[model samples]
Target: MPDLQLLCLSNPLLDIQAVGNEELLQKYGLKANAAILAEEQHMGLYDDLIQNYHAEVIAGGGSNIARGAQYMLPPNSVFFIGCISNDKYGRLLKKSCEKAGVRTEFRIDENVPTGRCGVVITGHNRSLCTSLAAANEYKVEHLKDPDVWKLVQDTKIYYVEGYHLTVCVPAVLALAEEAVTTDKVFIFNFSAPFIPQVYGSPLAIVLEYADYIIGNETEAMAWAESQSQSTKSIAEIARLLIRLPKKNKKRYRIVIITQGEAPTISAVAKSGGEIEITEHPVRKVPSDLIKDTNGAGDAWAGGFCAGLVQGKTLYECIDMGHWLAQLGIQELGAAYPYPRRTFQPSKD
Candidate 1:
């Protein structure tokens, strides 16, 4: 197995999650299942909701993925690149990363405020409102340092979040180009479904640079647009993504499409100029109940990256992703409490 060093570049935020009943929603005037951007006027409403419910705040987004990878992979094998302010939330984020055993290569800006995401969970569903504050200030210039470049070069895989593509296009493109030149694997998470609707063209450009692409069924349908209906099968979506032309045909090897509570389909490009689709049924754990769905995708990405770093086959990587996702939904946050296990080929 190749020694794996995974580098992730994206936004890191402190997530404040409040779980409540219908009364709590009524107090805040928050519509169920909708993410509303709260203004200063709504601060009191949020505070009241927090005080009414059992609330928990933790590190979220790309940092969550870094934390998950740290828990699943060998020590010092995972590194995160992002920006945060010298605020209390920023300090908390750093402490969380250290506790999870993830290396932090963060740029601290004293002028900008740290980023945050307010997650409201009502039963099985949840909504997120994000402020990309300090994260938006992260530019290509911050990554120009020799040490940062060296980390990129030493890494076997580079993971990117699609949410950062629009704001940090130049930086994302530069890193993707470097990954291509260095023959390092590049994995992309499509992130929220609404992102591609706004930055489809830039996202399309970024997708061309990815070695492997991962997304939920809703995100895939949104990206596919008029080509397929929303109810299309996961396999159909994965196949469509694989057929799409990229910069180098041989470079884009696999595309995995995940459907919640359904089998995940792995679409692989063959050397014989054919595309093959395989389905891996997720192992259902009967007692598992989903408390929050926020970090499920990030957890899946971490598991997939862990497999790839260990030189596991594409099928094995997909299976690892499914397994981790199962563990993630059982908890309130993305990082699940599971013992770290080195990848063994037989487990594939």
Candidate 2:
């Protein structure tokens, strides 16, 4: 395989997405377009979707972002590590990543079944209810393996999802420490708003080492509130995020906050305690053409990371991120169109 440039650690879930009616949403107490962790009442939701709805399984979570980066980067440039069950769904997830040219090092568990997310679609709105299952079985021992650690050493950039904090914080910290030690790039995403709200302690520790912190407006606000900055605006939150303590002083921090259908706020820390902030407007897509919003954020990270790996400027990276997110929403799931749309950077 080609040398790994980007390494991603997150829960690899098999997304079972299908359209449903109001009764289905009401049955699970799920709000339209909202994402939540699965509860006891959601136990049979996956089976019900398969048996009742026309469910389509897709590689989700970090796999979605890995595939997005692989779509833009050369083959084998992006590598993903996650825990999976020794089952058909796990095999399917592996096949999906391989098909997209993203390499994987999955830890297989014989006991639990593969993790899955049921994406209940109500027209353009999608409600995500995720059951971690075997994905939560990830152990730091897997990262300690000689071969795996070598992969980590070989990688130059690390992208970790906040959802993984629920699964393994030590493993994420280990990677973060390695990045800091090597002066490499480390990007952290607040995958969901609940992450910081519920796991504030671990989130605080990890944020100190993150060079690039990414999140949506909700997640950003949640983090701000958790950090006792609830009164701050989005741009203010970005500034605060970059000014957090850092172990590696060689690289300054950059905070990026995405607002759905609005402008994205980015803050960069400069020498002499200066913070530069800018807002990039979203590329508008007609409401009639929109499909699902499930993997839009993942697509954005994929595009942004791929651009970063290619030495693109921050503006170009954000543009590429928006491009991929736009492409993903036009599809039924968090996926891009086949035959790939070429992205040419603007001169102006």
Candidate 3:
């Protein structure tokens, strides 16, 4: 399994998701169609509105993906790096990680509260309003420990979330730099559409350091624009990104761009002089079968990373990613029925 060890660096927050019809939206004083960012004053109003609908509190964001991978992969192979406050939510986040068998190396911040996202879902569409809270308090100093550096050094791959690029640029860059120095395969997710807009420069720098890149259609579009291109398809976007020059092209070998329900394009730098492009068809899923769209991208990344860690070919990785994504969409939140691992862990 290529001696896999993953260091996932991102936020660990609670997601309060509300699912129902338009009447529920009206009850919360929210616009019937769009997602509105709610303040503290709106909490009371939201509480009163959600009384009529189904509300679910779950562990969310990159942490959820880390948890998924931990359960799906071999025991003690996954570790999560982020910051959470020493509050009630923080305690829950820790328990969630432990339950999923993910080791937590989170910094507890006293100044800020635990991070959270208030998600409102109407039919298949959903909106998120996040309060970074303690997640934003993470700094480069948190990654300075020698033990943490060794974890990055020994790891085969580093999976980072693009959302962290917006709130904790310095910390994110620090980890990326260490991953580069240690010669680890750096896999990054582009995350939300708004992330590239807010952290463009830092994200560009991080991309330069990345060995593998994964993103959805909207995030791919935003990243392509940042690269000064006008491509709309994920395949085109992946081609453009792979062709972009880097200082050490030999080390940065693969770029896989996923277009939801469409074929994924993979670009690989060869041992010889050629750059190869391979298109793999996605496994079809019913259009009306989706229960929750949240964390689908993250779940895909986790599946792709699992394949990579298992020494699967690029096509096999894409196939595994599609299968995992299908599993993710079938559930109400991320980390649904735990996935079965294809490879077993060794005692050595």
Candidate 4:
């Protein structure tokens, strides 16, 4: 139980990235910078890209953030649960997670094929088309295995992307329930604008258990809009998020919001019931250093979770998150390069 620092449940998918132009994007029916669920027939385009366009494939999903944190923390610190096919792609995903230092507890669906994400990198942005073949089939039943619950019991901190709500809110509720019952830390993020806009019901269920809520300016704004309070300022929104009632009344929660190169805002609940609002600015990345913005939010979530488990202060946690995102955005995918980032917090 002492070995695991974080536990996460996600819908795993393989990422096949290729460089393309806007025309190629339209040809595939994908919008820039959004992850869309593709139809079964859409896989033919992935075949086309692999055969001609020099596609790079790897394990990718919002859960990759936990995998990213494994690189920063000690070995076997992070564990993931997802559904994958009982096929070669499933094997590849397992191998990739191991290589990234993330332990996995996957349910193999023999009837379905492993999922895939066809990423089209058009200059500065990526349009993602995902086929959730086996991933969408993932259910709460998969985690019912006693062995999986053992890992969940060993965990002290849990981090999961908001997207999990769409797949299995019950599973998210299970993890959230653990966070509350055990008085452990549960870190959650609003993965995309659509999640708060469309899946607010499940999001609300998960929020009742979150100790830390992470989101970008757009997601935060969208969430505020969903609450019918669209006009709130960023600081105001974050403050409101932290003040939201939690299922566990004794919990001290916080909300962190990032704005690309702008100052990141954190609303902390003080020991004496004072709500302390802090702003931590980000370093501007040079155009050449900016690789892709695909996983910046996830990377931030991972770094912050790692910091939380290591018992760092809120300010330190924010700096560590920014540092990891800095390293990640310089790479091609959501992952850090071989010379992985050193777990050091930069001055705010």
For each candidate in turn, the TM-score is 0.88, 0.93, 0.86, 0.93
- Top lDDT prediction, candidate number: 2
In model 2, the runs with Cα more than 4 Å from the true position are: 22-36, 39-44, 346-348
**Candidate 3 residue-pair clash tally:** 0
Residue-level lDDT tens digits of model 1 in 1-348: 334388888898877678766776666567668776665644554344446665666778688777776666777888888889998778877777777777778888888767777667777767666666788788787787888777777777889998788568888898888887767788888887877777888887888888888888888888877444565667877877887766655475689877777777789888776889987777565654766666777887888887887787887877777777777777886658556544333242
- Who is ahead in TM-score, 3 or 4? 4
| Residue-level lDDT tens digits of model 4 in 1-348 | 249888877779888789877777777777777777788657776776777789887788855787777877988898988899988778888888988878899988899888888888877777888888888777887776798888888888888778777788888888888788888888888988999999988888788788899999999999999999957599999888887878876778899999988899999876876888888987567888889877888888888888887889888888888888888888888778776657765654
Looking at candidate 3, the ten consecutive residues that score lowest on lDDT are 339-348
By summed lDDT, the worst window of 10 consecutive residues in model 4 runs over 339-348
Superposition-based RMSD of candidate 4 using all C-alpha atoms, in angstroms:
2.1
Please list the C-alpha lDDT of all candidates, in the order they appear.
Answer: 0.75, 0.89, 0.72, 0.83
Cα displacement (Å) at residue 56, model 4: 1.5
Q: For each candidate, C-alpha RMSD in Å?
A: 3.2, 2.0, 4.3, 2.1
State each candidate's clash count: 0, 0, 0, 0
lDDT digits (tens) for residues 138-254 of candidate 2: 989999899999999999899999999999999999999999999999999999999999999999999999999999999999998887785659998888888889878999999
